[model samples]
Target chain A: MSGAEDFLRARGLWRRKPRGEGWLLSDVRLTVRGGQRLAIVGPSGSGKTLLLRALARLDPLDRGEILWRGEAVVGNRVPDFRRHVIYLHQRPVLGEGTVEDSLQAPYRLNVHRASRFDRQRLVEWLRLLGRDAQLLTRRQRELSGGEAQIIALLRAIQLQPQVLLLDEPTAALDADATLAVERLIDVWMRQDDTARATVWVSHDQQQAARVSTKMLALQQGRLQGGGSC
Target chain B: MLNPTYIELDASRVALAALLILVNGAISLALRLGMARTLLVASARTVVQLVLVGMVLQWVFGDRPWFVVLGLLMLMTFIAGVTAVQRNQRRYPGIWTDTMISVWVSSWLITSFALLVVIRDMQPWYQPRYAIPLLGMVLGNTLNGISLGMNALTEALVTRRDEVESLLALGASRWEAAAAAVRHAVRTGMVPIVNAMMVVGVVSLPGMMTGQILAQAEPLQAVKYQIVIMFLVASATGLGTVGVILLGYRRLFNADHQFLYDQISE
Candidate 1:
């Protein structure tokens, strides 16, 4: 697992209990290589979200380090690291603007300054998700939950991140929208499967089986039943 | 120009003014508003505090040495800083020191500039009569601005945690992630001073100008001083608001470009 192919690896990851003694997420280890679809399934309050956030470096780790491409991800490299490894929140947070503005927002950051917003590319991606260019003109506040999730997906995908940490990205969508999201992600993965990967935190085991080739179950902040499906 | 004879108020006249609070007490009693005790305590506090301040100012103004003048100014700045922090509803580690730094730097910097550059005739420049009153006015206004700015910053950070983190996750630097909150806080801190400037003479006669007029100064001279005071206050408030808000932004985020929203507590 400690190879150049390993894109993201967590070793002995620990998150302290927000209050009181001991760990909320204890001594967890995992590896994600290119071309892999890893799914983390766990019950509610099991620190699944904590684990994903820790991997994204959005939250602090108590006593562990995360490596990106066999290099310790640390200060100064964090923004660039986050740029490449985007985290899609469960509930989308769109700024006050049209959908096109939300998509264009990332380019304004200094880390993404080199990347220009390509409207043609976004239109193509939206079409794959059964959305039209008209959706881009609508205000974000007018978006449905499912539409917002789709916008969130396109927002990350447009950046061309190597790893997508999906934290229940479709938990709020209907069956059709969920399938559309899955299809869009499937297309994203197939586009550059060798260099791109995704780690999904999902509640639906059957959906997990359909989307992922490897599964890891978490219970009480401990990893269990790790194996290929 | 002939010096105008200023009418002096005796202690009995001040007592007569104090008796007007009975009207407020009567209203409270009639409405059963449970505020009579509060009104009484506040009035008492105002009298005691002002009388004590008057004595202190008299001593300081009476040919005090430079060190004593400097010491009193420092004490005033420190108290103003503490008062600003106490008015805020949120608490974070090192907030006191941050507030102190903002209040001290902004008020002292503008006050010194006024004494040395603006006024230009302060014999020895640290004369207690000029320095003490100028610094007091600046500190008073800066205190309000710092308090408002700190409150707005902390509240926005807490309520907009998700929005901030989303920007962080999207690869925004700490400044980029917290820019909107900083802007909002700085603007909130500045609004009161800006509004006061908008209506300084037309809507109300400011206390300093009124005091100067009562003390037999020419009305035009008093107006000139009031204009300068307003400008000094506006600058001090702007600098202090920006300083405190930026300090708060540094506290809530880190060098790692992380939004440490957990550090803030209600």
Candidate 2:
């Protein structure tokens, strides 16, 4: 029903029995154009996280197709797709070192080992999210939920992926922390005009209204619009 | 050091050794009735197992065939895997992979050290004195090491998984994120051996030393051999424990560097 010029696209894709314990995921289609912020929200067990995994290709789908830059992201190439199209979960899985180690994470990974990150760049992002410089040198297990979420967001953004997927990025934070994360999300969408599209999942109505230009709510394994901005 | 007469171990001496056994057994029993049952089972099993081993050792040690050593080595691997499964709940894949790698590295290291380095002139039909007992000691210690390492690694993987993934997100390869946990686990798991090595002679005489005395070896000879075995246990524990954890963590994390959800089903 639309022109096929999107940067990230998924159509008619499904996944089933991923871990072989009789668990399954199917019927997932998602797309995000460069600079667009799309939120996919639904209750637990409605397959929101599974759909994210399927689209990112972290978990396999039994049917349909995912396209990155118009090429089918199927077969073994799914791994490459998942790598470049980043995904973040509710709890930030921070590494075992200082704040600085996490911020420079992408550059150390195999996929992005050639990339570079400067302290100032991270500091710039941190400052935008209203964080001080001391947050970077501190240990991983020492950070508060809000700081960790921001650091995780900062790490994901550092990858500069074509599309970023977030599942409940601030679900574990307080009201002030949630407000801070909301601002970070807002800043991240405006990070660069055509840098990376974002697909954020949340149940917060005010958040969905704040920064999301496009929205989809999952119900019984299908997406429904929620007053798109 | 004293060569107590054979008659020195008569009724009075027998009565004294019996009293030591009974005292240790009683204290062990008071630890817990359930654990007491387990400890008793372990003691009985050890006695029975070593006796059965003694029966096999006659043929194995006397014949000293390479094939016999090979067979024993395979049994060592099997025992290591079964022990790892028992400790780690290894119904899934990768657990065996870790154990196999650990056994290969540690057993080989200890065996070569024993045969080529320590007890040189390893006759084509090596003395079971040098080979069998050493293998049993190394294999048994490696089993405990691998189990402890697997415990530390899996616990770190499942519990602090978010930290691991975050490290990956931080841009660490699967290996780097896991290295912290692996290193942490290895340090923790290897502590008992490390501590034991540090405090060996000063605090208490170990079993190997005590056994050598029982067999009437000279004090100097027994102490020297005890040192060698203590080092062997530490080396095997350190290397094998680190090996299993690092390798296991690599498999647990995927190619895209995402920590696989449902990694541990049981």
Candidate 3:
């Protein structure tokens, strides 16, 4: 099952409680192939976020290794790995600046030093989402929750990462904003379908069915069932 | 001008000054603050600790060898390190070692520069009378800075865990992710010494300067020494704060750029 098409693979991924108690996530294995939109659905406390974080290598793994393009992701490569496999928090955190500054922030990182912010592309995306270039000039603190999430999503997508581990990116958005986010992700994935994939952790099964071709269910820190929607 | 003679105080005169604690004890009693016992114990401790330190300094100043002087300075550095860490309300693994390294390196470096390069006329650079007092002032101030910086850094890291993690997730190196917190911590640590510098001659007469003046050294000479001490303290504090904060940043994040926020405990 691990093939060239497999962009990211997690085998026997496990994370223990900080106090050395039972596992918060254990024995979870999944594969993300190019052009795959995988949605993980679970009730609260089901470790969906934990699993996504573990996959992104944002959280330490106790029992499993994450493989990128058929090689084990290890030290030194982790930074570059994270650069390609970006994780978006459920509630976005934006620094104190205009939306453009927040978008430009990632390019400042050493990993993305070669990348430049594409202001025109951002404005075009904003037009598609029914926003104008003025949104970029708005102060981040003045942004609505939906606007902040939009900026956060654009920030990650602009980096052109190969994989996105989105932890309920729209959990705080209203219906219209959610649709805008889903549309943006759809457009981004299709732009380079052969090299892109996303793992969405959503509470909305209907939205999951709409956004994902493959769906997985999690419960009590374990995978229960997974199949194409 | 006549040479001014220094007046000496006997134990009886010191005891008379010690009676001032009774005023504090009476206030606590009147207010029913239940702090009278603590007040008495702390005052007693102050007298005992100072007397003990005075005795130790007397013995060391009595023609002690260089090794003995260095040993006493090391001891003072160790105690300052421990005290700095103990003042923290949070804990993490290896924090003590980090604090110790910062305190020892910063204080010793600046103290040595002051003793060797700045005050070159001493027959021996490690003379107890000069080195001990210089190192003590530097160590004391550096301890304050390290304690303040470490506390602020750890607290910011814990409180701003999500912000840090978000930055890490976006491919920020550990240094980039922690830059804001490091700046804040370093600034916090250096504030005291900076403020002391601002008010040194105008708003306050520093204890060392006052002591030198009482010891019949020329007032201008005392001012020069105090000026040197202030600059030494500011440099030591700034260096210690930066060192400890960087060390702490390394501890809180890993080589993979992942934030190990759980390592810290309130």
Candidate 4:
């Protein structure tokens, strides 16, 4: 596999205090190449999630430029950028709806209206993730943490995002479910071309060792790099 | 020591309502320091404002014309807008514009439909004793429904914004994502007024009903007026609340169609 493509290119990233507090991030520079699985590990409140949010443009950056496919994207059009590269929060807040509705939600916005969603591929994804395709008709309440997450991942996958930012995607699942999630991401990563890149925040060293080809650990908000392939 | 008896217009009875306002006001004050000030100021303002409206009604009821009727409609709209923003300003940022237009159109059309078609000659185009108070009650209550309806719906939108954004990310339009919340709010908001309509005569007599009796109007006549006001309140609440909620949606979202967390967040 070629490690040459850069799906997300961020430079000189900074986050200003919302209420004039000190900067959350300052002079942070990073590049995430296409199809690269980078783990951003940190203790709670270490700004790992903030870094992920900045990458996705979900959080404001006081000064910096974030580019998707060489187009400048920052404060404005964060949601638009997200359409191409989805941000998966650890505790994903899905609405009061059936699984199918949650899956089809982003399509409801004008930004994603132009893009066509392939639920047919979703059927395969559901099955591959050890979920029942029939479960789409069922409400979100019926799904377990593991099942719900697979659907969340599938939601991101359906976007066909070039880059995916995952914050504790498997943290809510059990060991068995975590293993299954790790494999699903692993197999998909090896097979999917440079079009799909990922930056995941995980605490588990084993999970990190499983999917990420390279890992970057964060200690108290600074990058401490280590990984096993 | 003199014991105060409740008189319909007795300052004491009025004082009782004043006391209700004071008690509610103080609690409202301590609970919401900012809102407390607004409530007290608004309550005092309401008394002053309503009295001014009462005088205006005396003049308007003497004769009803195209301009006068059309103008009173404007007044009703104004009242509704002020009421909504004052009651719950947070949910309704920049709402005064659309709300003014909406409240005017809906309340005017519905009230007129009832008056012209339903209560044909209860006129001089306006009757302070009848039309004035009727409009006030209906408009005031409808304002509440709109405020509440908008509040609940926007809240649902905020709380479920992720679900909303997810829908938008998928393929749904902004309105469709918000459809559940807005529709639910409008539907539920109309319930108190609607159920009141259903049980108007037997379950409870509306303020206007007991009001007319106190004024020495015939019982049957009072019942008829009560029915009209009930219908007006129900229709006004339903029609006005729905319009306000739907119109308020566009303002609630940013250009990216994301709900403004900064604006709506507590």
Chain B TM-score by candidate, in order shown: 0.94, 0.81, 0.94, 0.70
> Candidate 2, which segments miss by more than 4 Å at Cα?
A1-5, A17-23, A56-67, A70-84, A93-148, A158-162, A170-180, A220-229, B1-16, B19-50, B59-73, B89-91, B213-216
Question: What lDDT tens digits, residue by residue, belong to model 4 across residues B1-266?
Answer: 14433334655767678887788778877777566677789889988987897687667666656577567766767867877766763644566776776677667777777767777776455544555565677788788788788778767877776776555443344566678888888987787787777787788877877876776778899898777777788888888888888777767754444454555644
Q: Report residue A140 deviation for candidate 1 (angstroms).
A: 1.3
The order by descending lDDT is 3, 1, 2, 4
Interface RMSD of each: 0.9, 4.1, 1.1, 4.4
DockQ values per model: 0.74, 0.32, 0.72, 0.16
Candidate 3, B1-266: lDDT as tens digits: 14547877799998888778898889999999999999999998998999999999999988888899989999999999999999999989989999999999999999989989998789877889999999999999999999999999998888888888888888888888899899999999999999999888899999999999999889999999999999999999999999999998898888777888888888
Q: Which residue pairs collide in model 1, if any?
A: none
Predicted candidate 3 versus true structure: per-residue lDDT over A17-95, tens digit per residue: 8885899887898988888889999999999999999998887888988999888887778878888899999999988
lDDT measured at residue B221 in model 4 versus the true structure, 0 to 100: 96
Give lDDT tens digits, candidate 4, residues A71-189: 88733455667677777867666676898887776665666677776778888876876776797898998888987787787777777667778888888899887777777776567
The CAPRI classification for model 4 reads as incorrect
Candidates in order have lDDT scores of 0.89, 0.72, 0.89, 0.71
TM-score, candidate 3, first chain? 0.94
Model 2 chain B TM at 0.81
What level of docking quality does candidate 2 show?
Answer: acceptable
Best by DockQ: 1
Model 4 regions lying over 4 Å from their true place? A1-6, A9-15, A25-31, A54-67, A72-81, A93-142, A203-210, A213-229, B1-131, B158-162, B168-173, B199-235, B246-248
lDDT of 4 at A89: 69
lDDT, candidate 3, residue A55? 90
Which candidate has the top score in lDDT?
3
